[model samples]
Target: MKICHVNLASGYHGGENQTLQLIKQQAALGYELTVVANPKSPFVAAVRALPCRVVLANHYFAAHAASVTADCDLVHVHEGRAIYWALIQKLRHGVPYIVTRRIDNPLKKKWLANIAYRKASAVVGLSRDIVAKIQHAYPQLSPYKIPSSPVTYPIDETEVNDIRSRFKHRFLVIHAANMLQHKGFDVTIAAAKALQEQNANVHFALLGDGKAREQLETLAAGLTNVTFCGKQSNMGSWFAAADLQVHPSYTEGLGSVILEGLNSGLPVIASRTGGIPDIIDDHVSGLLIEPGDSQGLATAIMTVQANPQLRETLCAGAQQKLTSFRIEHTAELYQKIYQEVKSSL
Candidate 1:
């Protein structure tokens, strides 16, 4: 099957990574693929060696005029703006398209959005919560719930030991995400402060950089236990060395980094919102706390820090949970959707 996958975002964040994974899997399965992306996007370089074509267009209008979707069997829109590109292709050439919504934010009820969604062959979400929100916005649409798969990176044991060595006699707690308000960096900092006040040996390592970095750093100031590591390229080593992962995001489409922590055998303490519950089984695979609850987050961290037996149990459960979220499984599900959408036409 020939598919035109559209993701015009410039940066390669979680959503872009998921798109790359899907394209890689589909291409390996002998499916011909064409990518409609911004020339400046890191995603283009990521797919450089793949057996697929790359069509460069800065915006939906440019993509439409370029006629990139003319010969494809179906179009898979991976980002919001790209949805309009698919919509125009559908309207102009009768090409079927599918949209994958990765955010849990409320879908806007604009006229163009309504038409674009209504005309989609399938609307997919990365979590059940996102799917619920989509349904709430458009009752006539039944969106598919297809979460992202966990990506495994090679662990450099030397690097892992080096990271662990920096925090001697300390239990490392990792919070990996873009330094954003919705990502709850402030909440994590508050929890770190509480832990520091208690003179705990736990160290909080805040990874990833964003516009909120300076603000988050200012909030974390005077806390010797908190360290801003900035954007990390070697996440596997950090996850391997960390004792636990704390992700207290106000909202999450699906906790992709949480999945990585779990895959690395680290017990996670994440917020009980969005599709997080779908991954964390509350005290089973990991512990769950209400969003913005700094005290609760600190308490959960202490509980896990004090109990080796509980951590082991959660790690065991983590491995079991990862089985259903393999990239191959995600690809197979999407291929099924693609085939169904194609056959229906």
Candidate 2:
């Protein structure tokens, strides 16, 4: 089977990483794969080393559709704008296509989304919450619910031990997210401040880069417990060195970092928004706090810090859950979807 994965985004984030993982896994399974991406995107360069075909094209709907549809058996779109062009191509050529909705952005363009859904052979929702939202928005566009398949983000276990040696016995807390307002980095900083006020001996590490970095650094000013390490290419060491992972985002389709933290045996403290609650069973694998609640976040952090046994229990549960989201499992699910759509076509 020939599969074409389409993403026009310029930067590499969870969605692009997931798409790359899928492409690598599927190619290993002996399927022909092609990636349609932006010419100037770093993502395009990253995937060049992979064993798949890469096509750099203009972002125009008509041009991209015309170029992609001719040689591909199925087009799997990973972004909304690309979905529009893919739908147009599918309608024009009767080729089957699928889309993976990765965010919970309010559907301001509901009509356009509906049109794309109508043309798609299948829609892949990364989380059940997103699936519900899509169904609610366009009841006519019934898409399949395939919660974000879990995969361990590339992290080396050896580097984790090295990081632990560097931290030397200090209690480490990691927040790995883009420094965006909606990601709630401000709340995390405030929570760390609250912990420090209470004389807690904890070190907070911010891992990721974006527009809000300077503002977040200002918030962390005078606080000796916080460190902004900027963006990291390898997080295995960070996850391995940390006692806990905190994600205070206002929304998420599914927290892929939470899954990565769990796979690394780190307990997570995340916001109870979007599809986060589905992954964190409060006190089971991780703890959930209300979005933007600094006080609640601080208290949860302190509670986990105070109890080593509880942390161990949660981490163990997280490791067990990791098995369900292995890259192989996610690849198989996509393969099944591709097969079904192909048969229908």
Candidate 3:
């Protein structure tokens, strides 16, 4: 089957990474695939290295619509802008398309989103929360909830060991998100400060770069225990070296990094928002704190650090949870969705 994946963003993030993985896995299964993105996009370069065709075009809806509709059998769009373009292609060339809704933001732009939803043949929501939002915002569309396949990034076990050896016995905590206000990095910093005030010898690692980097650095000033590692290509080492993964985001469709950390055998301490509750059972696999609660976060950290057995228990439970999100299992589900769409066509 000929499939076209469309994303308008120029940067690489969880959604782009997940799309890349799907394309790679599908290509291995002998499906014809093409990617539509900006010419200078990192996604374009990344997809180019794969065994699929890459079509870089300007943001003009007409240009992209014409190009994609003429050759692709199915268009799998990643976001709102891509959905709009796909809608145009469908109207002009009768091309069927699917959309993946990846965010759990409030649906304040309902009218605009509903228009695109009505045109899509199927809507793929990354989480149950996202699906509910679509249903509430545009009930006419009846979007299906297809959990985003768990993300898998290449990691070297030997490298993980090397990193862990250097940070020996240090209570290391990592927050692997782009420095952003919504990501709640400041809350994490506050929690770290609270721990430090109690004379705890803990280290916090920030593993991404974004607009809030400078601000976060300033907030982390005078804290020798905090290290902003910027963006690392091999983040698995940080995951392996860390005692806990902290994700205090205000909103998320699904925290893929949390899953990655769990897969690496580290327990998560995240806000109880979006599909986080779906991934983590509070006090089981990980601890859940309310969004923006620095005190709650500090208490959880102290509890986890003080009880070694609790940490081991959480790690074991997290490993067990990893079974449900295995990459191969999610790939099979997507394959089934493709077959279903193909047979209907």
Candidate 4:
């Protein structure tokens, strides 16, 4: 089947990465694929080598007029702005489209937005939390649940060794995400400071860069335990060298990094918030703490650090949880949805 995937996100993030994974998997299955993206989106570069056409659409208007899906059997909308583009295609040309909602945030309660969602062949959410939000915002709609999957990147052992060398004899805790306000960087910093006061032999390597870096850095000033490593390209190496991964987001659609950490055989301690509980079973797979609780975060960190058997158990549980979230399984589920939607159309 031929498919046109539309994602007009301004920058590449977790959602874009998931789109890339789906496109790659479908391409392997011999499906002709086309991607409609903003001209500056890093998603364009990421799929350039793949067996698919990448069309540039500066805005939703361009996306609608650009004949992106003339030869495609179906459209997959990966971002919000692209919904209208797909809706237009369906109305004007009878092109069936599927909307994949990735965030737990509620949709706008506007008439046009509601119509756009209602017109889709199917609506997919990355987690039950996201599906519930969509249903709450649009009671007439029933969104299907299709989750994001764990990613495994190639690891250079030398790079891994280099990272471990920098923080010798310290129990390293890695927190990787854009330093956005909702991501709870402030909570991680507070926990790091608390750990420092206790003279704990633990360190935090904060990964990724965003608008909140300066503010977070200021908050972490004079704390020797926290190091902000901005946007490293070799994430697999960093995951390899870290003792634990912490995701303290106050709210998350689904923590893709947590999946990656689990795939890397790393134990995780994350907050009990949106979509996180779906991925982790507290005390079974990984530990969970209340969002923005620095004291709780610090105590959880030390709990894992003090108990080697618990770490082993968590890692073992993490591996078990990962089996259900493999990219291959996610891709096959998407293909089934595509077939069902297309047949109904």
Candidate 5:
């Protein structure tokens, strides 16, 4: 099978990483793969390192469609903006395309989004809830649910020990998201401060960086329980050492970091928004609190930290539920979608 992944985002983030993992997993299965990405983007660098063909185009929608789409049996659009390029590829060249909508945010310019999905071979949402949302917005289209890559690496013992020794709190929590408002940086900071005020033996490390760092830091002034550990390249080590994962995002398509935490055998307490509930089974795999509810978040963390048996139960549940989110598993499902798109040709 020949597949081309078209992404226009310049910077590599969660969605880009998920696309890279998809291409890598499919390439390993001996399928022909190609990527259309920005000439200077980090994604192109990673794609070039693989066996796939790299068509360096800022937007394959207008300038490079003929070069990248003429021969490919199907194009998989990896971003919202890339859908237009995929649409052009299909309408102008008859190249079939599939789309993966990775966010729970309401679709803007509804008519345009409708046409885009309507033209695609398949619409994939990273979470089932996202798929349901799409269905409600555009009932004519059938969207599938395919979560992002799960924890693919084993825990590095050395790195784990290093982190463990550094932040030796009775309970170590990891809030792994870019420091942005929607990611709930304020909520995490408040929860951490509250936990500290209550004398809870806990420490939190915010693992990713973003534009909101300075503001969040200012908000968290004088709080000793939270540490901002700038952008981390290797999250596996952090997860391996953390006792619990706290993700209080205001919105998310599917929280990939939450999956990593569960796979690492740590409990998670996340906001009840976006695709989080898809990964966390409210008190089963991990606890769930309403978005922006710092008090509830603080309570969940304290309760989990105080009960070792509950921690063990939640961790065990996480392991049992994590298999479905693995990269290999996700790729296998997309492989079927690719085949279906190809068969339609």
Candidate 6:
């Protein structure tokens, strides 16, 4: 089937990454694909790499709606602004589009969101919790749940070992996300303090940078164990070098990094919020703690550090569950969705 995928996000985060994965794999499956993404975004490169067309629409209000409609049998939108453009495409040219909502944050302008969801051919959330939230606010709209793909980049073992050796004596824990309040930087800092009180020989490599970095860095002042690793391109290497991943986010749509961690066969200790529970089971695939609970986060870290057997068990479970979150599986589900939506039209 011919498809047009739209994403207006400027940065290539988890949601954008998911879009790239689906488009690339589906294109390989013989689906003619076209992507309309922000011109400034690095995501344009990925789309160009695919056996597809890449239309650079930097603004949400760009005038490429008619052209995008002319090229595809079905339209799929990935992010917020893209949803708005898709709505216009549907209204003006009668092109039906499906939306994938990736955030748990409540819709600010209810009327706008209601119009888009109602008009869309199908709406999908990345997890059960996200679907529930969508259903609650817009009861007329029955949302489906299709999750993000667990895709990790290749890592060189020699490079991974070299990075690991830099922190030889300390147990390294990695937290990767854009430094946002909802991401639970405060909770992680508190846990770090707790670790420090006990003089634990553990170090945190906090990856990704955002507006909250200055404030968080100020709060973590004097905590030498914490290192602000402002956005690294090689997350797979970091996963390989680290002991485990810690994600104590107060809110998350699906926590793609956690899935990436599991994909790398690195066990994770994450807060049980939003779609986290959908991917991770407590003491099963990985460890889960209550959101914003520093004590619980600290306790889990300590438990993992104390027991070598627990790490082995979590990694084993993660490997077993990995197939379910693979990009191939995600692409198959989306292919089914595309067929269903297209046939209805």
TM-score of each: 0.97, 0.92, 0.91, 0.97, 0.95, 0.96
lDDT for each candidate structure: 0.91, 0.81, 0.81, 0.90, 0.86, 0.87
Distance from true location, Cα of 157 in model 4, Å: 1.5
User: Global lDDT for candidate 4?
Assistant: 0.90
**Residue-by-residue lDDT tens digits, candidate 4, 1-345:** 999999999899989988898888889989999988988888898888899998888787775653667888899999998998888888888899999998888788788788899898889999889999998987888788888998777899999998999999999999999989999889999999899978569999999999999999999999999999999788899999999999999999999989999889899999999899988999888999999999999999999999999999999998888787888888888888889987886
Candidate 5 wrong stretches, greater than 4 Å: 60-65, 110-112
Number of colliding residue pairs in model 4? 0
Candidate 1 collision pairs: none
lDDT of 1 at 18: 83
Query: What digit string (tens of lDDT, one per residue) describes model 1 on residues 1-345?
Result: 899999989788998988998898899899988998988888998887799888888888775653576678999999999999899888888899999999899999899999999999999999989999999998999889888998887899999999999987899999999988899989999999999978569999999999999988888889999999999999999999999999999999998899888988899999999999999999889999999999999999999999999999999998899888998898889989989998898
- TM-score, candidate 3, is 0.91
List residue ranges in candidate 2 displaced over 4 A: 62-67, 150-166
lDDT of 3 by residue, 1-345 (tens): 788889888778888888887888888878788888877568988889988888776573636546655767788888657787787777778888888888898676567566777777777777789888878877777776666555555678888788677566678888888888999999989988887768456778888999999999999898877888898889766776678889999998888888888877887899999988878899888899999999999889888988999999998988777676666777677666766776788
- Local accuracy of candidate 6 as per-residue lDDT tens digits, 230-330: 98888878888999899999999998899899888788999999999988888988999998899898889989988889999998998787777787888
Where model 3 places Cα greater than 4 Å from the true spot, the runs are 60-71, 108-112, 155-169, 343-345
CA RMSD per model (angstroms): 1.2, 2.2, 2.3, 1.2, 1.7, 1.4
Q: Of the candidates numbered 1 and 5, which has the greater TM-score value? A: 1
Worst ten-residue run, lDDT, model 2? 60-69
Over all chains combined, what TM-score does candidate 1 have? Answer: 0.97
RMSD of candidate 5 to true structure, Å:
1.7
| Candidate 1, residue 112: how far the Cα is off, in Å | 1.4
Candidate 2 similarity to native, TM-score: 0.92
Runs of candidate 6 with Cα error greater than 4 angstroms are none
